[model samples]
Target: MLIWERPEPSARASLSPLSRDRIVRAAIKLADADGLQAVSLRKVAAVLDAGPMRLYRYVDTKEELLDLMVDAVYGEIPAPPPEGDDWRAEVRSLVRGIRGAALRHEWFADLLGGRPHLGPAALGHLDATLTALRSAPGIGDDPDALMRALQAVNGYVLGAVRHEIVELRAERASGLTEHQWQAAAGPYLARAFAAGRYPALAHVVGNGSHQDPAEMFDAGLDVLLTGIAAGA
Candidate 1:
């Protein structure tokens, strides 16, 4: 059975005082500091001053622990402020919330949308998003449209966040800012552009200014919301 389906153990007097909550929190801390690769049952147990075998009482397998960690990150996402009937505003806020959470816990982008998140925190975030989208006046009483709308927004967010995280990871690993990285390969790019085979790429590369990431994400989201509004 999934961890969420299992009843939480009641608090009992004990010297260890260890619980699933503590285990998950410790794992999250490790992940936040050193990425998901740093997390393991043995390491989590070490952090909690317990043996790895003891962890099995709370989590049946490594996958369950990962699920708990993912859910913990979801719990960090704040609810959208009261934006009554303004589906766009509400959704925009929730989208930003998810992005913010991903940025804070880079490992989150690695796990999210990769599997079904059945934990309470994950379910709560999904429920909140659906509620916000359901407020769309034009989408009223149409279950199919509402489901599509939710999936579309979630799909975009998942893809975009993964892309952002990948770029971030690359930048960190290479020890170079994007502009610096581009300049390092300027000679190669110049030769390629001069070939006249990729006119559109060259034109855009020459004409486009460096855009702020946040602004770019917001602009893309706006385009999506506009299309949704028109269709609904």
Candidate 2:
């Protein structure tokens, strides 16, 4: 059974006021202000103005706490569109909502899929996606096809968001904007291109338009959605 489904102890119900919700919230607050690494039972307890032992009443391990934190963030994702007639549009909307949530929680990309997330919010998000895919004109009741469509969109979002997060962290570490960093590295790239080793890389790097991250993400999403439609 999922952690949330486990029965709570009745003996200590009146003795302790802590609940899973409060523990999860405290952990999320710590993660938001600091980072995932800053979150611990001790720290969370301190945030709640309680002792570390008090937290043990709600959560047993740090991994469980992290799972709860992940679910809490998933709870922020917007629900799938109600119409659901346009599968592509619904998938696009859902994927973008997840991306936005990841952007807001910088640490989210690192901990995603760290464990099986069977929480109510996580299940709700998955069910919504399945409903949208099933509603697609050609998909119908084919489980395999529905899974493939879901994975295609979900995988793209995860990979894209992870790449974005890495680039963002790199920029922050270097203390330079993306353009500034590219300009600084231009001479090295020019030298490499001049060596005539990577013709394809040289062509794209030299001729490609400097599109913003969002535009590039949208373009890629469109390509994936088109492929799914064709397969459907």
Clashing pairs in 2: none
| Candidate 2: residue 104 lDDT (0-100) | 90
Q: lDDT of candidate 1 vs native? A: 0.86
Q: TM-scores of all models?
A: 0.92, 0.89
**Which candidate leads the pack in TM-score?**
1
Stretches of candidate 2 above 4 Å error? Answer: 7-17, 114-116
Error of 2 at 12 (Å): 9.5
Best candidate according to lDDT? 1
* Tens-digit lDDT string for candidate 2 (184-214): 9999989989999789999999899969988
**Alpha carbon deviation, residue 147, candidate 2 (Å):** 1.2
Please give, for residues 1-232, the per-residue lDDT of candidate 1 as tens digits. 7788887676556656679999999999999999988999999999988878888878888788999999888888888889767888988988898899989999998897755699888888888888877777678778898988887898889888999999999999999989899999988878998987688988988898757778878888888888777888
TM-score of 1: 0.92
